[model samples]
Target: LDIAFIVEGSDNVGEENFNIVKKFLERVITGMNVGQEDIHVTVMQYSETVTLEYSFREIQSKESIIEKVRSIPYQGGKATNTGNALNYISKHTFTLVNGGRQDVPHLVYMVSSSPSTDVITRPPRSINVIPIGITPNANIQELRRISQPNNPIILHSYSTLIEEAPELVLQSCCSRKLWTEIPELCNKPMDVMFLLDGSSNIGASEFEEMKNFVRAFIESAEISNTSIHVSVLQYARENNLEISWNVPQETEKLVEMVHSIQQREQGPTRLGRAIDFVVQNAMSESHGGRPSASKVAIVIVSGRSEDTVEAAALSARMNRVSLFPIGVGNRYDEEQLRTLTGPSAANRIMKLQNFEDLSTMITLNSEFIKKVCMDPVRECIDEDGNKKKPGDKWTLPDQCHTVTCFPGDYTVLESHQINCERMPKPVCHSNLPAVKIEETCGCRWMCPC
Candidate 1:
């Protein structure tokens, strides 16, 4: 979750009350776990103009954030410019460059005791705006207009607001385990293989967590040899096959093998060798990898590979195998991981703080694989963010979402950055592929008219 607090610093706000607001924020920050993958909080003080007191990207620790909050000076101005502040946040603050992930929920809390000088229209981005009125003088009607529908305005004096700060913030940053309820894609035939890093860098404890992650993933999936064939391989200097595609169509047996699989420690991280091993040994028809089924290889890496990995990963993709490289530790090379994962790096390459975080990958991995198997026809996108030409063959990065456009005989109008659902009804006449929408809006493939 990404949260931004927009505090009103007009002349109406006395220093004592402003200090209380800072304390309220301090309490809120203390109660939350502020980290890169977890909650990130930013603060901006607004009067006639918005002043960014601190960005979430800069402060990852709760102590650091609270200390910075304490140091923030009051920017008292003549009147409140709430509309301009919202506009500024919408245009500049809430962006990927500013540590904002579009997939996560964004929330804004506005603290004010006065009316805005301008109208508060809906911002360009989707965000839940909460109006926190500090005094009875605050405009209730304006708060209603600015806030999310049915979300009550938190109207209280500075002292009272400080007291209820913890409860209010908890409501905004509650556990998102409920949000992970994605519908399972049943009866989708897929041949999925996992290439796990068991190098010394990963250690025994971390490897155990990785195994648990695989087990959880298998348990969540609707697995059967006919439905979704599963395979597991541990790799370092060499690869050791734990489970094969030809294994019985029993989920229990597969999970049993996952639990029994031991670590292959004290080997150099020759990840390239492991990639080639999957392409040559696992992805073959004789190895229970159905050519018609969705073929995917998930590579989990803890540290930098001792050998080159890009070419071998490319080879697997050329053979119609989707590649997903998960970089677990902070020591792993990010660029190399991106190269191995291919395009759409954000969705493909998952960087974790430690092996303990592998549990989080279970949901993401299951959903991504299921989605790809539901529709395996992935179109390649170019560096210019345009769809690849027909027959200009390319491999899709792992979790690469694409929408095929049908161009029969009519002129195929090229549209960019549009919602697929909002596009005109598919009346095809051109020679383009039919527009197939994926579950995520991350796809930038061509959408036909």
Candidate 2:
């Protein structure tokens, strides 16, 4: 991976705060495995002038890079020329001559405390720009523009930069890894249902953003009759099945269908009812939902539901359907969103700040595919004809062996061995002796009075 840290060194970023930025860089670099062949690090500072503190070709070791980042002088100037810095990195820093490889991913961490004075255009597709905004003066709109289809990291103050360094490094590495593994991960067979909120609360423009996100997400997956089958449903007071999985269509046709969907713009967000409707109709075997395929539901909710979603969500999970609820705007009920996906809410639920941020979620297509394909639902049935889900454990009547239900293909693990050393010693009554009964792995003591 080729990573660049583009720091804003304008006059507004005082010397003391600039030192904090340097500390942030040092901490982030320390977390990554930096080497000549592994990850190439480049540092640049921009204001009215753009200066390359160090190029990828110059720094080959992690220690050298961190030291260089610590020692580089801040280029203090009046104007915050971020556009110029981005252009410079694209043209000069990431070139083959500068140690940027065509096969590896290029990522730019643009850290700024204020808005850019000049107009900024989107960077090349080859380069991913993650804009980190610090202070209230930092323009979120500008950051969003710079990092289209990817959410920008916003920090309220420069003091927290060092604290967020570990997370920064993790996000950087995971983003690159997902981009490389998406194609292979999205090849499995699955049934995907898009449950969209089309209430009056969601204006026509915001609804369009939802459609764009869905289109981009679908395009990222390998959609076919054998691979992935998709269905679209819009809900407000009523549920409208826009597209059915049974209709076998090509990728282009499916995307066009999504683009042409009109907003219902009704009243009362009946998300629970919509979920029930989807489970009964859209996910039915008659609707092209394969019995062997993994089931997934992507719920895009814009407003709080008038009805309770607990029952319907529970029903979906019981039917082996994974629910991914994406709550949009602050008005969305956080509790309801969590309930939609049950206990694993952290991994399944997504909360966007507003409707505009929905577009950024398209980048999560790979993550969604990984969730449905890699971690699928599995169950096991014991000899008594009782059903058991993954991570469940039980002991037989003899109490000699233990049974464990693991994920993937109804795997049942039985163990006859027991660790007597870890078990509590048996107590004897009336100062009687305790007899040792030998077992497969250890011995069990029997008390005799």
Candidate 3:
């Protein structure tokens, strides 16, 4: 569970009003049952609204989190432009939010004392935006701007300030043993770099497969709905740019663009070359604003390659972007295949194990892409702002609730990310000391494990 908070530190408000805002935030934090270890706190104070405070990661102790929340100094000036604060928090802070991949919930809490006169042109990226208006005159437009009236995006008002703090915790970290498994993808923008194999060794069918996988991801999760922007080209016989940086939200165009891929070109499967392409590109785009989610992922697929993928895989791993390599067949390098999984067994690069069924393979790949895009796709966007792209969507599991970094059901978590393809399997971590659910998985017929 990852939690990010924003409180009005607008300069125009009075000291008394400032204190009320701080206390209101503190009470809510205390009541959320947010423990020290369960959350990473970021304080954005708005006077002229520069991110007055940055994030303090993983404070498990509620007192520690509260003290940090209280540490926000009061500043008052003119009208409360909550939109600026929201813009700052949306752009400047939040990349470290852990539960981004649509598997773990990410929660953004906004407590404001005034209104925002500006119209947000940038889109909002996080999954759930919870806006609580502390003042009677608090900007309802800003509140509605941050939230959706229906579903997870909530905009509820109180008659007065939160006079009393709830004595009990909203939810406990340890008690919610299932936290990691729950499908809670945040609406924070994510930084994703995809590395594709362009070598001639990758076949026509495989090329089409790769292209569609990218297309589905671009259409279903990218564009206006997500923060994921895919780059690079097919590395086969010729190297060409299919998508530079922009990702299409609507599937029709992306699908058309990909299906129309008449050229399958690039050099020898330079897997390392592709990974390096992303690393170099990503470093330059590092905007100062704290993104809604932390880290990025490098995805690679190849059938054959002369150079080793170890160095590239390790480099991406160090950058906090995991290297996911898909091996096309027995001829593909298993060592490199395994290497992409990284240092921990949990990070082991998983193979399709069977490729006889293209539909299953494509479905599995699509599911993985959906899970991966959920967070950064959420992060890279500004909810109240203009839609970057439109006609894309990724729905969360029912067990999931509005993002709060809250713990989720135990069985649904596998790698702390959800893969919808394996429905009813009670996805779980195999490396863990124990296994809980006994129910069989939906793909049991195909399982030879």
Candidate that would win on TM-score: 2
Query: How high is the lDDT of residue 387 in model 1?
Result: 61
Alpha-carbon runs more than 4 Å astray in model 2: 11-16, 99-103, 113-116, 119-123, 134-151, 174-181, 188-191, 194-270, 280-295, 300-321, 325-368, 374-449
> What's the TM-score of each model vs. the native?
0.47, 0.60, 0.37
Regarding lDDT, does 2 or 3 come out ahead? Answer: 2
lDDT of 1 by residue, 329-412 (tens): 678888778777556333666678767556544432344445445543355544234565544533234323233333321112
- Model 3 / residue 186 / CA error / Å: 5.1
Best to worst by TM-score, what's the order? 2, 1, 3
Q: Look at candidate 2 and tell me the lDDT of residue 91.
A: 85
* 2 or 3, greater by TM-score: 2
Clash tally, candidates in order? 16, 0, 66
lDDT of each: 0.70, 0.77, 0.48
Higher-lDDT candidate among 1 and 2? 2
Residue 87, candidate 1: alpha-carbon lDDT: 92
Instruction: Identify the leading candidate in terms of lDDT.
Output: 2
